[model samples]
Target: MTKPAPPGKAVREIVPGDSRWAELTHSDNHRFAIVPDRFVLPRKGHQVVAALQDAVDDRLEVSCRSGGHCGEDFIGAPRRNLVLDLCGLNRIAATDDGQRIRVEPGATVGEVQKALFRDWGTALPLGACSAVGMGGLVAGGGYGPLSRQLGLVADHLAAVEIAVVDEGRKVRAVTARADDDGELGELFWAHTGGGGGNFGIVTAYEFRSPAHLRSGGRILPKAAGGLNVQKIIYPWAMLDEATFATLVGRFFAWHEEHDRAGTPEASLFATFFLHHKSAQFLQLMVQSDADIDVGGAILAEFVAGLTEGTAVFGIPRGGLMTWLTGTRYMSQADCGDVMGARSASKSAYHRSAPTGDQLAVLYRHLTSDHPGQASYVMVNSYGGEINRRGSAATASPQRDSTAKSSWFTAWLDPAQDDLQIGWLRAAYEEFFAATGGVPVSGAATDGCYINYPDVDLKDARHNRSTATWHDLYYGANYERLRRAKRAWDPHDVFHHSLSIEL
Candidate 1:
């Protein structure tokens, strides 16, 4: 059974011409639309659940939006529907003992980091983009540079507070966890790696913080080394497919070897960014928390192997910026504000390394129709603790797949939407096909990364693979996610083109 929708008077008042309505309608990453009839930002979880129930009874489609970063039309859809904006519900509550932190779904990862840093020198292992909403990131199985040290963000989840729709236009507030409540735990597990806004509305998340260590009666010394950032840039035209493949493959191999050797260094993080243009270029960021010399030595060896007469140039170091506590929300806010202002991004994951021939094809495509903006393939290494956990232990289904890498192509020209999108899609499809469509099930490819959500894989118009799209993203857990969806949002009130289907 569930509680009925609250009376009309309880619903936040709104009129069609109001500024708030305009702001809400135009607020997501995909700015394009099917505007909603009304939008509400309930301050409390119970209030939101009640509103969702009422919207369901009215036969209105509901779209859950937080930070408006669900790429594509998930947040902007079906004009006469209702938009439940949870961004205003941001709140961070710590448990009495301080071992656990409870966060509202609307809270940004940056905010969480800030809160943790303020209370204690603690932080959650989340994506590098601070502006990403915690609700969506955790739900989609978050991974970042720190992932090598802490595993997926979902690994630390303790519980989730969600609003489930049930029994004839009613909603129930349920606390789902792994212990003391197995049914609810399953729901929590599903949400951990399952795509966002598909099952139910998650209002809050409870996570266990790492324990603090002390020496004798005093706290252990603060970490000694400063942050070091190394930048490596290579001209795009100079890099052919073979060079790119060698660069990516060698990096992955190095990361794997280091992980097996049990060498964990907080200062170690590597990323490769490609810019698509006449002067196409590759930029790599090597971040280390160790002594600059030691970090440089390790990085130099890796870079030397890749740059051996390959036209690789520019090895500069960006000095450490201030080390802030808690999630870097201010930084992410800048991204959201920019994305909100106007931006488009597309992403994909690889299950296997691109072969030499496939690389040639990719190089041709990237150089042929290069967009003026900084368009390039960004690769981050996943080693250390990331591989220590079994794939099934968390909702991130890609754990078992050999697709040890994820890549993205991002640029900032709103006017070039069609051209840019088409280029990305075509290149991605060609790459996937050449690699045996590793992202599709039954192909050597395991699944796609939920964080880099691509609607094409599921759209019959674009993807013709025999493998069902959902299986590639959720693996064997797709069925379980469906069951939970049936249990919580049976009517499929919360839906988008590529969201989990019941």
Candidate 2:
């Protein structure tokens, strides 16, 4: 129902005072603080890029928004001279006899899942959060529960449609693919995992679908009686350093053992939440890949091993639920509400399991003396089919690394922003120090996940190390990404705080 801007007026000057304007630029977590000068929804890629170039000529900063789920300032900021909203371009084109899909930058993961499932009984390796935008997620190195079996989302990318600023022209929409075998191909490679909005504005992506499908046009096999999701909640008062260490260590060990066996049927995810009142609670969500009984048993045994002779306990349960159903995939209304809030977060990737001492350090930071801060620690199991693929298979550079876990700490307190931000950074630094500072360079750490875009890693503010922007995201692939950036965005028109510095 939206209309195009009037001629001769820049997109920024045509701002609407309606509720939709606020909804378009807001985020779900309510953490980011951004308000673009203007919101422009282009009907197609060509129009979007043309407007972006105009903003650049006018010396306006641009922030690209698709689903607007980025946890940080990557989108929705007044500093953004122009807000390029791609939601209008949401479309899915089927190809490769229904084994391939070309998705617009604005499509939500949930929409894609439903569309693919309804049409071809196909699904992409998508994240649990359905509201996440496809553009940012894949560009930031997408991961999900299916990641252990299939691989990261970037691994499936075949090609991308990008709008880069040229020296003479403002910006041009060009196709970048593995087959190009030219400078553009390298740029396409960077787009695969270099993080979105760094090299250029990605308008569409070409992806390969899974080789097979389940009945009812489902991508994954239906969980017997739906998914058997077991949730265990343990009050914080009952957890001490030893208990926490035992639980974390045992969980890591179980994942490593199962992953080595090749089946890795049980999917386990744990979240330790530290509330404002010094209260602590642990919630664990377990899903059996295919066999509920076997998966449940594995989790049961693992929990028992960790809590043996201890007072920690959990309730075992299960039910019928599709992969998307259990994850609380978002509706359009939910997406609107989430983008309108404010919050901040930090994340890290661990190449190895933390030792008992390291775990204790993390506990102290989370339970520190902050008045109105809530911190959450999520440990997800990595490695399985994800590791079987070679590092160079796609733009994702973390394959060669031994990292078994990824962690995120989020706090919601506008008044205590400084305190919360400092706490997260210090805690992360302590964690890295305890582990010999896991290299941000691809050579040592395989670089960090792009989805959790951290400007600190690239800026001198927190990361004083000599790691280049490419080194932080692409590893040895950084050089290739740089070549692509140079070729496509030779004018450096599409850029932001943490964009790849060429």
Candidate 3:
């Protein structure tokens, strides 16, 4: 029999036939699901420690879930059936000095933002997805619209609390602070971009911007004013192959010039959503936290340049809104409940603009007559303050990349999985055909983002890149991460498919 949980903490057991079992096994990408031998939910850190101890005693493989947004099957292990649902541990609060904020793993990015703004009138540069949990996002080096101005969400980390098992097989909780010495310091650095669910199960994180320290507590960084957002759409019917390619080149050229470290234009952030030809239209969204007029002018200038020769379907307008309100506007698209649709995503990091040949391949795929599948390639502007830090400063080494691109597709039918999955993979493979079927760390591209995990990196059939998956994701920091993993999780209690190996 399994040991009982500590006092004041309850552990609910879920069997295969229970109604909750089906729901619990489901993940963000319904493409993969697993029926575990045991399932438990812990509401607090001590309970998590107790659960890990129990798992160790029984020699059971374990895994954890926060927001369940993993695009791959990392959260779903076939033999590892011991899963911990942390939703019950949701909590958010600010430190007494008003400089650092403490957030629980279960708390969504939306929840953390609201709490930070409400308690201290400050915010962190996190992903736009409202439902992404702090656990995976922060550990994977999160970035969003504000990242160009401030930096990665991981750059602001002050400390982290995690649960692990010791060599003697005893359950224990450890806190690793940025100011700590030796192993603790390494542990903290590993979480900066090493990716979550590797070293241990994270319980809480403390974050504070470096600019806050520079100000001597007078003012926070990049939050002095509100934000201005501009959303523009162009019907695909109006965009011929030449015009689409022209606009794409123009967009790339503009970002190459503006998204430099310490430049005034660095405050301007934009994302070009190029949907498949079947979607009927392409959308370009720009956001700036600067003065409304300055932001509007910048947006207007960029839009004007992109559509100089071609006729734009609808000339969009710029609107000014508070940070909270702007986030609400951005979050509107994903406001609904988490659907159980099968999903797949592939990501790439580019140091320069896409080559003419690459753009042509994209056009061919978008216009191809394939199954009516829903998919899109999102090109998000990267670099600015994010590039000021050197590769060795954090586990995230893609600091020099100018753009982060992701190919995402979703559907409800299992029968069409091959058609949709093949479409996504073919596009990615063709894009990096020059680099042996992957984005190798070089002048044109700098590997892929760890946050956008892709298991294909480990498969020889798909990953033809000369560099290994660790090199693509961690660059020179892979050894450091592996060492830290060996030190903290020698028992390999917390791990997944792409986890750091001892």
Candidate 4:
């Protein structure tokens, strides 16, 4: 592990041979990582501005990295870019009134959760993976198991402090808040779900709970009764074609029926992980904040809906644990572990369940021969309190979506890259053939999640849909985000392949 740089200051230098330099260049995804000429480690907000100014003065390209868990190569510049390493800015503190919390961009979700719960007995609806940095996650409309009841992490954002490049390419630190009257408020709106490394380098974020939500033991949602999680596994070998189809159909139908803002089942969240046929099993994990009495009932009802003709291998019950303990367990550490693997992913915000043909396509591809070593189709319940707000309320416009489907496949060796990537692409295209090879925003498909950040949407070959990249990602909110970008980052200092185009 790299030691923390000194506090209340920043460090900028070139370390082409340092072990940490090599490690920092690469992230959770090994598919991309172009080395930079220098690494700028900023310890504080002022230091972040100074580092940006230095990079601009040197005429070097710039990028920022917090947790380095991005699926794309936003931080992995392909040229002599100056990368701002923000890991040294980890800080979490609350306002004097205790109603708002200030979190530095480098603070991971785990750190934020622990601090919020320990200090105030409250929590934020952040990503399930603790390793995820607040910079990208919150900016990309983060959510976790608690999202169904609490809503997206971005919904809680009160203000954001960012260092942007001015017209002369000089660095300027600007604070945008939700309550700001003019352009500053719009700038803050863009950060709600504009995706990271786009508008500027964010140094810190302030999160505030709504007045109505101030009474709960936990700021976001009540976990006083404890949480119950259940994992049900069904071996694919035991599942006949009918059983498989029925299970998938039932899972989709359940969400369609109950995925409203407030409902009895709204607190119950479930995820279906459908691995390749060769993997021989599908897993459905469900969790709820309800206590043992109603928790068991909720889990039983959800399982019963999908077990019509299916034979399950086992249904393991997860023990009850306090909100803090359960959160600690849910924070995944595998995000940045290995870096040699190559993978391709595609995401969709489903407004409706998959059609019969779509389901058939998924089944055929899962069982087909493919070079990819591991592949899975994960469908997570979306909507609930997340949809309580309107599409234009934030930069993330997939509020009406009831479910999110993610198609992913991974493999080792550059030799298998084409095969694995091709396999995932084919699967996604076929699944949405009715939508012109992409999940176009409409009655059935409400576009894709920006957090997933699929560059494939930019290519005409992959996105045959009438809607373009901006349309699918931002919907009607694209123009607003564009304005924010032009105003704050006229020179387009912070950018990526799929960033908000000027």
Candidate 5:
């Protein structure tokens, strides 16, 4: 008989016929509903060690899931049936007078944000999706509205606690921290943006922003007193080809020029939702902390500049709202049950505005409507203080990017998957055709975002670039990441499709 969990602890093994099997095996993408032989849900770090050891003993391929938000089948790794669902390990703690925060892998973004603000008056640059887990997010370099001002969540990662299976097939735990310059430090650096499921199963993280270290207080980043948000829509019906081109061109130029290391523009962040014509209106959303935006003048002037020489116009903004309320509102924009929504996403890091040809491609796609699918192109403000640190400082190397983008499409019908996926690929390929069907790091594009993994980049059928898949995701940091992988995961205990190869 298997050893039982320790007293006051609960660990469950779910199988195909178990009552909670579907829940445990479900993926957010729904493209691949993995039917693992079993899933082990553990509530503590020790339990993770035991579960991984069991999987290794059984000779079962292993994979891990934090929030199941990855749009691909990486959690299943296509065929790995022994899944380690970390959702039950959720725990959040703050110590050293709230200056040192430790978050368990399974904690949700919303839960972490609430805890940080409620007790410490601190915040981290996390994604907008509240239910997204911190494990994969932090591992993939967390980015959000606050990122332009505060930098990536991984940028402040002080330490990582992980469980690994050694060559002896015995599981062991190790704590790697940033302050150390030894082997452990390299492991810690790998987690900063190396993407999860590569090195090992992370159990916990210690967050200490540079500001926190320098001042010995104020964990993460300072919480803004309030936030001023403006959501404006541009009716596609009123926009001509020339006007649409101008609107997008200006938006890109603005972010590129303002994305400096240290500047007041860092206080402002924006996202352009260029939805397909089926969605009626394309939207522009901009936000800033009230502490840096007095009387909303910064937002007003910025909007005005965006609309200059275009048919678009800025809408009047309302007064500021408390940080909690504003963040909640921000979360609401992306919250909901995305659980069985069949979706696909491709990301690009733009060092410069899309050329006129690229803008034409965007305009063409936005005007044409697909009957069975939904699609949109999102351009998000990136690179302010995020650019302050060089590429070698962390595994996330897109430090010189001006803006980041996501070409997305979603559908509910199983039959519509082909339609929606093809729609996104066409748009994405055409927009990046100049770079050989992928965003190869260069003068115009800075490769892809690891957080938004697209296996298509690895398929020669789609990607015509000479650059390998690793080149697009890790850029110049690929070699260092490979070395880190070899040093840490010798037996390849933890791995996925895009994980650094040993």
Candidate 6:
């Protein structure tokens, strides 16, 4: 929670009883706050190497945290664990020609977005969590509001500087480029969507297309001067199963029909948030780059199409805001004080709309947020530029999905853990009941998004599908990611519950 040490300040190790230790120990996810023995705040990549070497020298387990938004307790080992908080390494440097921009692992989504927009008039399609670290987000194939138009943030990753340990336990910092055509190239490919904490600790990433995306100009996509964002809220108070189904089906149907890239509809994006009826309203947030959509006509047309035949109408909430301002607002409104509450998120990518049986399951649980608990099911419009890439081109292979959905719930009290977890688990499990309890890569559902890692996918009791957790997340790319893991982190210096196997 505390700001990282200022530049040139002495970076020190914080131990138990140090006032700073308590502040730095807890991650954004409050449920499983790590209890590492030592915490090191590294100001530079060399500092990261220094901290890592000490761990290797002492034969202690090492884990690195950039933004602490993993929402899982996977950073440090149970025994003697040395935790490296890379927040101090925050830096975003751009090339003189502006064709390349290198972002340090510690830079946040908000910081990166602001910097890119202000300096080069460019932007990355990062998720809504402003506080999320680029270290993890980009590495896991970052996607968000602009994703449908510009592709993923990972699609722009050209190079990565990672601090890895060799077989001799010697720490070395190496920059893996996409064109190396060797182990380094494979390493870079793995990082494209392999997720964090698997290969090694990432230091800095240069933003440019791994593949030759264009003839020339800036490597990243330019956001239309700002954004045209609008919020529409539909009252659940007036909704019956039929009405709800109409609204939901219409939203997905519209996306499926107009999912093609490089069109006016592709410029528009929407996130349909279905909150538990206890919240009283379902929200549909839409936005389009002003540069392309002009007066936001594209956005308006898309909204109208989603609600055309529905009996219910959605009332506009916030009129509109600038891209940066509206993005900040969306992040805050969607995830209010997440650091103060404990939350669980499960995700899936849908190749097509859900069946009637699945809609009934959604209506059943959504009607009851469980007395004191709060929950929401969010479906973000997908396809477009994201689907243009071939599946095997990168480590993240979920490129054919139309819409991505996230099932989430948060509670303040520890006592509600079982109630909240149980509710969300049932919601997700029953939704994919036809596939043996998991969103197997099939006709309706493509697979799960790796960024939204769920350890539950690994447990047979929860995931009763023949498809392993590997198939649900990585698909055919799992084995390739494993090869990179073995080559880079042979000793498994960095690991987590769902880290790729060697």
Per-model TM-score, in order, reads 0.85, 0.84, 0.94, 0.94, 0.95, 0.94
Where does candidate 3 have its weakest 10-residue lDDT segment? Answer: 212-221
Candidate 6's TM-score: 0.94
Candidate 2, which segments miss by more than 4 Å at Cα?
1-19, 28-33, 56-60, 76-78, 96-99, 210-226, 260-279, 291-295, 327-341, 400-413, 434-447, 458-461, 464-470
Residue range 1-502, candidate 2, lDDT tens digits: 2445678533333355755765654665566545766678776777777787788778777878787777667675437767888777789877556545789978988888777666655556677677777888888768775566566787777778888887675677888775677677677677667877778788898886343323465433232333445556667678776777777777766665655314645244333333322545676655544344444565566556767887777554454356546444211234332234344555555455566667777778766785433455566667766676666666776764333344444444466667766766777667666333434543324446767666667655566567665566677876676677777777666666666667
Quote the positional error of residue 165 for candidate 6 in Å: 0.9
lDDT of 3 by residue, 1-502 (tens): 3445557658666667766777887878888886678678778888888888888899888888898888888877745758888887788876677656778999988887777676667767778888888899989989987788778998888899999777788878999998888999999999999998898899888877786323546223535356777788888889888888888888888878876776667777888888888888788888876553464677668778988967765457558888788765655234332277887888888888888999999888887886533688888888888998999888898888888898887778899799888988999899899997889999989988887888888998998877899889999999999999988989887777788888
lDDT of 6: 0.83
Candidate 5, residues 1-502: lDDT per residue as tens digits?
2334568769877776666777666677877777778777888899898888888898788898988888778887667768889998788997556557899989999998899889878888888888889999999988998888889999989889999877687889999988878778889889888898898899999988886323325666778889988878787777888888888888889888888755677888888888888887788878888887887788878878766866666444444788987887766334333445778999999999998999998888777768522578889999898988999899999899989998888777889878888888888888888878899999989888888999999998789989999988888888988888888788887877788999
Candidate 1 error regions (>4 Å)? 1-15, 209-226, 237-246, 259-262, 265-267, 291-297, 309-311, 320-322, 325-346, 372-374, 401-415, 435-438, 441-444
Candidate 5 at 360: error in angstroms?
0.2
* Residue 242 in candidate 4, Cα distance off native in Å: 1.7
Over 4 Å off, model 3: 1-7, 96-99, 212-224, 292-295, 313-318, 332-338
Q: How close is candidate 3 to the true structure, as a TM-score?
A: 0.94
Q: What tens-digit string does per-residue lDDT give for candidate 1 at 1-502?
A: 1122357434363446766665566654544654776677777887787788888778887777666666667777555567777887789877676546788878877777667666655556667776778878888878765565556677777788888877565788888875734567678888778878787898988886322322222211123234455566776666666776677666655664565312544236677665565545667766654443354566566667666666545556465544462113112244423454434454544444556666666677757756535445566766455556666776776663332444344455577677666776776677777433445644335657776666677676667676667766777888878877787777777787777777
Candidate 6 positional error at 92, Å: 0.7
* True-structure RMSD for candidate 2: 4.3
- What TM-score does candidate 4 reach? 0.94
Measured on C-alpha atoms, candidate 1 has an lDDT of 0.64
